[model samples]
Each structure stands twice: as structure tokens, then as C-alpha cells.
Target: MNSKKILGSILLSLAACIWGGMFVVVKIIVEEIHPIQLVFLRYLVAIVFLILFSIIKKEKWHWNTKDFRLIVWIGIIGNAVSIVAQETGTWLSSAQTGSVITSATPTFMVIFAWLILKEKLTRVKIISVVMATIGVMMIVGIHLTGKHVLEGVLSLVGAAFTWALMSVLVKKVKTYSSLQITIMSTCVAIICLLPFSLNNTTALLKINFFEPKIIFCLLYLGAISTALAFVMWNQGLTMVEASSSGLFFLLQPVIGTLLGWLLLNEDISIGFILGTLLILGSVWVSVKFAD
Candidate 1:
């Protein structure tokens, strides 16, 4: 109802939309690049823009040695591990599968927020999360997948859980600005990813990364998705409660699914529309009544 919460909600929604579109881009680009190397390159681009933005905004680079481990762990979980898993899973599975499976992120976030952040799950919040969960399941349907999909499914599930934990941990942080956190954590992540990316980077040198389409996708991933969306998501966390914040993530599925259908020729059913309505309802409830 208040302006700050409204702003936070908008930022969070925008971040979700950006990330949803990221799947499409990743689906395209990951065909040409390995997932780990892609993540590494994405962060390489992100850190450059982040630092420049920080400099322009005159954001304090204030940091304490004690919190270095926290930042590093958060970086590893969210930036390095989750993103690598997500891209790999998407590569192995259909784009829709990637989006739909990871839509479970909000449910994981709710649980983590309760356990780690000790944010109370109000009746309203619980109902909203439940409704969104049901909606996601409905969209996915009964026949989940066979053993063939096990690897991708596990990777995506791990991504969701780790990402959720990182979100809650980020909410616990109050001293650093989002810009500061994003820059520092991203730097740490780039270092974390370096060793893994060597072989892939060697492979990368053989490909024409400068292809027009690939370049455009890389720019979008690095600048818009990673740099802009991350700052928005993190700053939004500062404005709202961690529990309510997760509800906004439900939007990612709708956005990702629709984009996947339009761009990737992915299928959609009546369930998608019906499920999306439930998700929207849940988001509205979260914004209006969540504790």
C-alpha cells in the first residue's frame, strides 16, 4: 500500500521478468557455449558494468573483513552454483521445463525465509505460497518425467534450493548496499568459477562469440539480466519482508512460459492460463495481506 513497498514490488516483478527472458537467451547461447563458461563470462561482463555503475553512483565500497566469508558463500551459492546449474539444466531439458521447475523457487524461498531468516509465515502468506505451488504443479501436470530427465531435474532443484537460501542470507545483510554486495559477491564468484571455466574457455576461443545474435544475447544476459536485475532484486529485498518477497518470483514462470511458447515454439495448455490466474491471485494476496 505504501510507496516503498509498491516500488519494491515493481522492482521485484521487473527482475523476475528479466530473469524469465534470460532462460530463452540461455537456451539459445548455451548451445554455443558451455554452461559454466557462460556463467563465468556473464559475470565477467556483469562485474565490469557493476563497478562502473558503482563508481558513477558513488556507492560506498564499505566492507568488513568479518563478512567476507558470508559474501563469498552467498556468491558461491547464488551466483556461481545456482546459475551454472540453471543453465546446465535448461540445456539438458526443454526451456519450459527449466522455467516450470524453477518456478518452485518461491516455495523454497518461503521455507528458507522461515527457517533461516526466522520470518514468520503468516496464514495469508502460507495460503498464497500454497496457491502458487498448486498453480505451478497444475501447469506441469501429473507425468513429471522419466529417468532420462533426472539429471536436469536434480540440477534445477538444487538451483532452486541454493538460490532460496542465498536470498534469505541476502535479506539478513543490512550493512552493505545492494550495489556493494553485487560487486563484491560477483568478484568472488568470478574467482570461484575461473578454475572450472578453463577448458570451456579454451573451447570458447574456437567459437565465433562475436556472431551478431550471440553478442546481443550475451549483452542482454550480462548487462540487463545480471547487472540491472540483480541490483533491483537485492535493493527490493531491502524494502520488503523476505517472506512476501518470494511471492513475486511466481511471475517468472508465467513470463518464461509465455516467452518460451512465443520464441521457442514450446507448447502451452489451458492449464497455463488457469494456473497463471492462480499465480496472479497469489501475488495480489501477498502484496495486499501477507505479514
Candidate 2:
């Protein structure tokens, strides 16, 4: 209802849209690059861009030593662990399975915020979460069957929980600006990922970085999706309650579905239309009434 809350919602929605569009580009590039290599390259570029931005702005990087633990937890669980789980789950299962499972992130976020941050869980918020979650299931066309059903399902569930925890944890951080938080968390994540990524150095080296399309995809992933999106998300989280922030994440799937229909010529079924309306309605309910 307040200006800051409204702005936060809009910024988070924009970040979700960028991530939604990224699904299409990632699908294309993943075929040519290993997941680890791609993720490594993305964070590497993002960190560089963030450092330069920080330098240009002359932002102070100092923080209490006690806060370092929170930063590390965020980087490890939010970035490193969640990413590995999601990628491994997708490899073991189908992308549909990954999408459907990850859609539960908002619900987990609600629960985590309630338990960890002591955020209020009103009736309207509960109903909105249920509505948005059902909409996501319908939109993603939930399919549990995959090659390694148990492993994939567990991994995806882990990813969803970790991602939710990360979002909630962002609200707990009060010592750093959004840019500083983004930079520190990303640095920690990159360090945690280095061991795994090092093994794929040969694969990374094999790719032709000079190629225009490859360069474009990498920049999009690094600059827009990683660096910019993280900053926007942290800023939004700072402005709104974590539960309210969770509602905005549903936009990712809705946007991703629409993009698929438009770009990939994917079918737009009646279920998809109905689901989209339900999700939109949930967003309205959460934003207008939940608070």
C-alpha cells in the first residue's frame, strides 16, 4: 500500500520477468555448455561487473565480523547448494519436473518467513499462497515421473527449500546495502563453487568466447540475471515482508509460460489460461489485501 512497498513489488516482478526470459536462453545455451561451466562463467562475469560498479559508486564494503556468517550462509545455501540441487535434479529428471517442484518455493518461503522471521501469516496470505501454488502446478503441467524419480524429487525439493530460506535470510541482513550484500554473497558462492568448477576448466576453455551469440548469452546471464536481478531482489526484500516478496516469484512461471508460447510455439492450453488468471488474482490478493 505504501510507495516503497509498491516499488519493491514492481522491482521484484521485473526481476522475475528477467529470470523467466532467461529460461529460454538457458535452454538454448545449455546444449552447448555444461551446467557447471555455464554457472561458473556466469558468476565470474557478474562478480567482475559488481566490483566495478561498487568502485564507480565508491560504496563502503565494511561490515562487522559477526555478519560474515550470515553472508556465508546465504552464499552457500542460496547460491551454491540450491543451484547444484536444481541442476542435478533437472539432469536426473525432466525440466518439467524441475519447474513444477521449484514452483513450491513461494510456499516454502511463506513457511520459512513465518517460522524464522516471525512474519505474520494472515488468512489472506495463506489463501493467496495456495492459489498461486495451484496455478503454478497447472501452468507447469505437473509431471512427477522421470528417470530417477526419488533422487530428482528429493533434490528439487531441497533446492526449493534452500532457495526459500535464502530469500528469508536476506531480510535478516541489515548491515549492508543491497549492492554490498549482492557482491559479498556472490563472492562467497563463487568460492564455494570453485572446487567443482575447477574440474570443468577444460570444458570452459573449449568454448569459443569470441562467438557473438555465446558472448551475448553469457552477458545476459551474468549482467542481467545474476548481478542486476540479485540487487533488485535484495532491495525489494528490504522494502517488503518476506511472505509478500514470495508472492512475486510466481510471476516467473507465468512469464516463462507466455514466453514459451510466443517464442517456442508451445501450445497455450485452456488450463494455462485459467492458471494464469488464478496466479494474477493471487498477486492482486497478496498485494492489495494481505498486508
Candidate 3:
């Protein structure tokens, strides 16, 4: 690969690592805070920090009407809606179920690209999707139970669709600087979540800033996960093909599942391991053979 591509890949890999740890952070924070309130605060902190960075860098905050609309759409689908759906799913379902089900993003990406980006639905793509779907089913097949399964499935479906839309939108907006686009979308997310944050003022204010968990989550969310990871992700999206970017995301579930087991002492089963392999294998096929 060229130097730019290699750099983008490394940055994206780093972003994925941070994101893998983020689930653990989110689970911890939600132990005390409501999902809505937690997400609201996370984005609120992210917005403040990003704005500060923008000011320090003397980055232009201005955008034309068209760019503003795209940024708003990105913020809505990628940040606001996707987070709500994922968190709601996590709240309702076991972490295993939520994690496995949400791995269905590539399926939605195929559909969305066909509709929006006019991307091809090749035989390899179809087979890859099937393999990934089957893999996820194998991984969480045991934990799929009760009405929570339905809730988890619904939340995951929403997450898949919304995130897929956001990816396509970002791909379309690749002309802009990744940093500018990241800041713009984060600003929009803050605006979208402002009312919720305002309503939860008492809880937010009462939150002890000195708590190690809270402090860690806030910094992790604001600086590493949201700002830096997104900058890397946008850069990757700009430099790489959409299909390739989509393929790299398959790393998320593998890394997340292993990390969950290690950090949270979550159980690992034969099914999960098998499913993970299948998913990874399918993604490999997609990346290697889907051309």
C-alpha cells in the first residue's frame, strides 16, 4: 500500500481499538446514569472539547448551506440516532446479544449502498453478507431469549441502518477536510442532544467529576473515542474505498468480544468463537474477493 493508505489503515486500527474499549466504558457509566442522560453528556463533553480544539487550531467554523445540511444529516444518523439505538439495545438485552446483533452493519451497508450510492450487489457481496449473518447468529445464538431478543434485534437493525446511512453520507462528503467534517457533525450532535442535556441538568450537575469511572469515561469519550477516533475514521473513509472501509469494520466485533471477556469477565463460548471466526472469514472474503 501507499504511505497515505498505510497511515489511514493504522489510524483506523487505533480507532477500532479505542472503540472496543468503549463498550466497557459505556457499560460502567450506564450503571449509574440513564442511557439518554449518559449519551447526552458524552456528546456534550465531546462538543465542548472539539470546539475548544477548533478554536485553538483557528479552524474555520463556517460552512455553506449545502455542507451544513450534510453535516446535520451525518450528526443525526451517525452520532445521535445510532448511539440511542445501540444504547437502548444494550440496556434491554444482554451485552452479548447486543454486541452480536449490532455486528449486522455490513448487511445494512450493502443495502444502503445499493440504494443510495448505486454500488453493485455482486455475488461476493451477497455471499459475504450471508456468511456474516450466519456468524453473528452462531455467536449469540444461545443468548437469544425472550422479548429482549426482539428489542435487541430491533435496536440493532436501527443501528445498522442509521450507521450505514451515516457512512454513505460521509463518503459523499469526502471533499471536505476530515477534521472540519468531524467538528461539524459533533457540533450538530450537541445541538440535537441539547434539550435532553438541559432537562437532565440536576443529574449532570450532581455527577461527581472526581469519580474515576466518570472522569475516565468523559475523557475517553470526548478526546479519544469521539474526536480522535472520528478524525481517523473520516480520514480512512476519505482515503480508502467504501467497500474496503466497510470490510475493516469486521474487526470491531472480534476485538470487542475478546475485550469484553477479558475486562468484564464475560463468558466466552464455543459458539461465540465460531461465530467470530465466520464473521471475520466473511469479511476477509469480502475484502479479498469482492472486487
Evaluate model 3: give its TM-score: 0.87
Models sorted by TM-score, best on top: 1, 2, 3
CA RMSD (A), model 2: 2.0
Can you tell me which runs of candidate 1 are displaced by over 4 Å?
140-148
Clashing pairs in 1: none
lDDT of 2 at 281: 90
User: Model 2, 110-140: lDDT tens per residue?
Assistant: 8999999998988988999899888887887
Expressed as tens digits, the lDDT of each residue in 1-291 for candidate 3 is 567766765666677667766766776677677776777777777777777877888875555777678878999889888977877776666556656766667777777777877878898888877887787677655466667668767986798678777877887773467788888887777788788767868877888989998888888877888888888888877765565456555556666667778887877766777887887787567656755
Q: Which stretches of model 3 miss by more than 4 angstroms? A: 1-9, 52-62, 145-149
Determine the backbone clash count of candidate 3.
0
Clashing pairs in 2: none
Q: How much is the lDDT of residue 10 in candidate 1?
A: 92
Q: Score every model by TM-score.
A: 0.95, 0.92, 0.87
TM-score, prediction 1: 0.95
Q: What is the C-alpha lDDT of each candidate?
A: 0.84, 0.81, 0.73
